[model samples]
Target: MFNEVRRRRAVQRVRPGDGRALKRFRWWQLPFRALFYLRLTRDDGRRTVCAVDVRHWRNNSSGNVKACLYVDGRQHARSGLPAAFPVPGGVVEVRMSAFGLKRCHYVTADGAEYQLVPDGDSAEGRRAHFDRRHPALSRGVGFLSSIVLVVAVFLLVVQLAEQLTRADGVSPYVGAFSSPVDLSAWGNSVVGLITLTASTERALRLRHSWLLDGAAG
Candidate 1:
């Protein structure tokens, strides 16, 4: 019920876009821009191209960001973050996270889902390319990221537990406890930085976990 309401509000944010050509991704926009593409052939034997473009830094100015949908290179429709744009036989869903995009998929009427391909010049595209070029190394890096996030989450839980046990109201019920992996302020800072990098790396692959990326974000 709650999810249905949120979906309706998100649909309400959709607005028709004035036909404008989509711009090519540039090197300077690497940190702020993300672009993805989908190609489909109709029953009539006609090919169509769909693109999803987002500019992350704009949220800093307006506190709200939007996703733009393009068809065959021209703007088709747009909506605020978490957009759902209707296309030929499916809806293109775009979602953002604090670090970058968490989702960009095409869902067909029959429930089939597919991730759109990132623009070749974008960071996500480069990451995908690396995965293809160096499958073994890529898997190793991905595994390392998961390990880092898991350790970070565990430490976080331990610290929270210790803190809760120290509270006066809770101390009597659950005696004072200390974290086994104690770290100084500087050490904590380093861990925070490492976890942030791990989260960003995972984001590039559109991999997110509520307990991991959520806490990092």
Candidate 2:
């Protein structure tokens, strides 16, 4: 029931797009750009390719973050973040987190869903390649990312709880609290960097937890 309502609201967010071909990710655009592709076959046998392009770095300059969908090689639709484009076979959903894209998948009418493949030259593509070529190593990295997120979230919760106990007016009733492994301000910054790295690595595989990732963000 909840999922259905979310989808209905998401579809309403879609906006029309001027037809434009999906651009290849450039070397200089790595930090600012993300592009992903999906291909579906129609009943008559023709093929349609869908691409979701987002320029987060550019968004900083424009003051708007948006994701565009390309059909075949031309832009078909666009919307602000968390877009859902109606495409053949299913809807292509796009969503972002503070770090980067947390979801970009094609969900079919029959309920099957698949994450689109990234371009070969992109960071996501490179990570996918590593997964295929070295399954063990990829699993190890994934496990490590989970571990890092767990530690980050634990510390974050502790810090927040301790801070709450010391709030201006509530301390007299609840009493002040202190975190067990409290780090100096600089030490906390180091943990923030590691958390960012872990979240980015998980984003490569579209792995996200609302509690963990959302809190970290």
Residue-level lDDT for 164 in candidate 1: 93
Instruction: Supply the global lDDT for candidate 2.
Output: 0.85
Q: In model 1, what is the error at residue 74, expressed in angstroms?
A: 0.9
Model 1, residue 213: C-alpha shift (Å): 0.6
Q: Residue 148 deviation, candidate 2, in Å? A: 1.1
| Model 1 C-alpha lDDT per residue in residues 1-217, reported as the tens digit of each score | 6744665676677899899999999999988899999998877889999999999866523367878999999999988888888888867888887778999988787878899999989999999999999999999999999999999998888998999999999999879988999888898899999999998898899988888999877
Clashing pairs in 2: 20-75
Q: How many Å off is the CA of 113 in candidate 1?
A: 0.6
Report the C-alpha displacement of residue 142, candidate 2, in angstroms: 1.2
